[model samples]
Target: MHALVVDSDAAESSFLSAELQRHGFDAQECVTGAEALEIHDKFDLLLLDLRLPDIDGLEVCRAVRATSDIPLIAFAAGDHGLDRVLCLQAGADDCLAKPYGLRELIARIEAVLRRSGPARTAPRPATDPLARGSLCIDPLTREVRLNGRLVHLTRKEFDLLHRLAADPHTVHSRARLMTDLWGYPAGYVPDARASRTIDTHVSALRAKLGAPDWVLTVRGVGFRFGRA
Candidate 1:
């Protein structure tokens, strides 16, 4: 496993790097945001310090998010509520306040890595076709693959994909998806928050697949499942 540690403090960066190496990770250290950005694609995971010499870590997170959905954890020395929230909203998968224990950090890293780890090797294709372009979905195994490459997805995410892929080219309104997937009647509740939940799951699913273009948003309607 590979990781990128972006902490300006030499001592802190060294300590993190050493600990990661001890745990069997090939860790790289970058002291500035610019350097981190330049080396982003090469690293599997990022240990981003919220404060950098060139820019705030939130900006860096946003920049990284624009191109990739690589797992990211924000580490900081100071307490900044807004920054922490912004980091998550901007695209970070996790956050850690500094003065943190190495053991805890290691645990968090392991957990995140495990969650993002690759799925088992390709399985035999099922009878149904739940797919978009090169991506294929299997409800039996609760898995989706792009060109035979497994794309990891959470339970809710897999369900959402299954719904869409089960009927490709068919547009399903958000209300319909929420009612069908979440088992909530549309008119039962006035708020209809379940509909919005579909949006979040779709966004996350797209990000996980590294392509938001697959799920087309039909203006004033719902989403259509198909490759553009």
Candidate 2:
């Protein structure tokens, strides 16, 4: 698969790009987030550095996520806990603290892809439920079971949970979910109400699901299921 690496550091960018290429994947390097957005749709995945010359990587991640669902991996030069969280909140699939081994980077890439890959279109039973660790969601009954007990969820909560559970590790933006759940009707600008509604639904969903952190906040973008 083809991947793009967005980094301002020339040597680091070249090294990562070359390493990805050596692994039999087509890789390209871009020096700025602006450039990355200009061609975001062309790549399958993105390796983005939190620091950039023109824009913060979080902004880039948010912008790209406005329309695309491409996997994003954020890179940091040091242990910036808040920055890493911001990256994840910004719709990055995961973040890598700086000074990490190249092998670990590749492994993360593979693991993210594997975890986010599409599920098979199967004929689910009338009450068929799927489980991932302690989380369980029943598609037919619209019931959520966490730790083997029925949990309560509002309509929007159920919809949001269903959406996230549809694809583990897949990053989704608030705008996307709003459209999917509420349809936005027409000519609606995403405002505080939109954000609050989604957040409320997510909060209730998490409380009932018994895994508050299962739904992750990607800073300025939206939320995603699974860990960053």
Which candidate comes out best when scored by lDDT? 2
Across 126-200, the per-residue lDDT of candidate 1 in tens digits comes to 457565678888777777898999888765577667767766678987666655555444443414334444566
In candidate 1, residue 221 scores what lDDT? 75
TM-score of each model, in listed order = 0.61, 0.55
Model 2 lDDT at residue 102: 92
lDDT of each: 0.75, 0.76
Per-model root-mean-square deviation over C-alphas: 7.8, 14.6
Which parts of model 1 are misplaced by more than 4 Å?
A: 118-214, 218-224
Question: After aligning candidate 2 to the native by TM-score, how far in Å is the CA of 93 from where it should be?
Answer: 0.4
Query: Candidate 2 on 9-105: residue-level lDDT in tens?
Result: 9999999989999998799999998999999788888999888999988889888755455778999779879888787777777899998899999
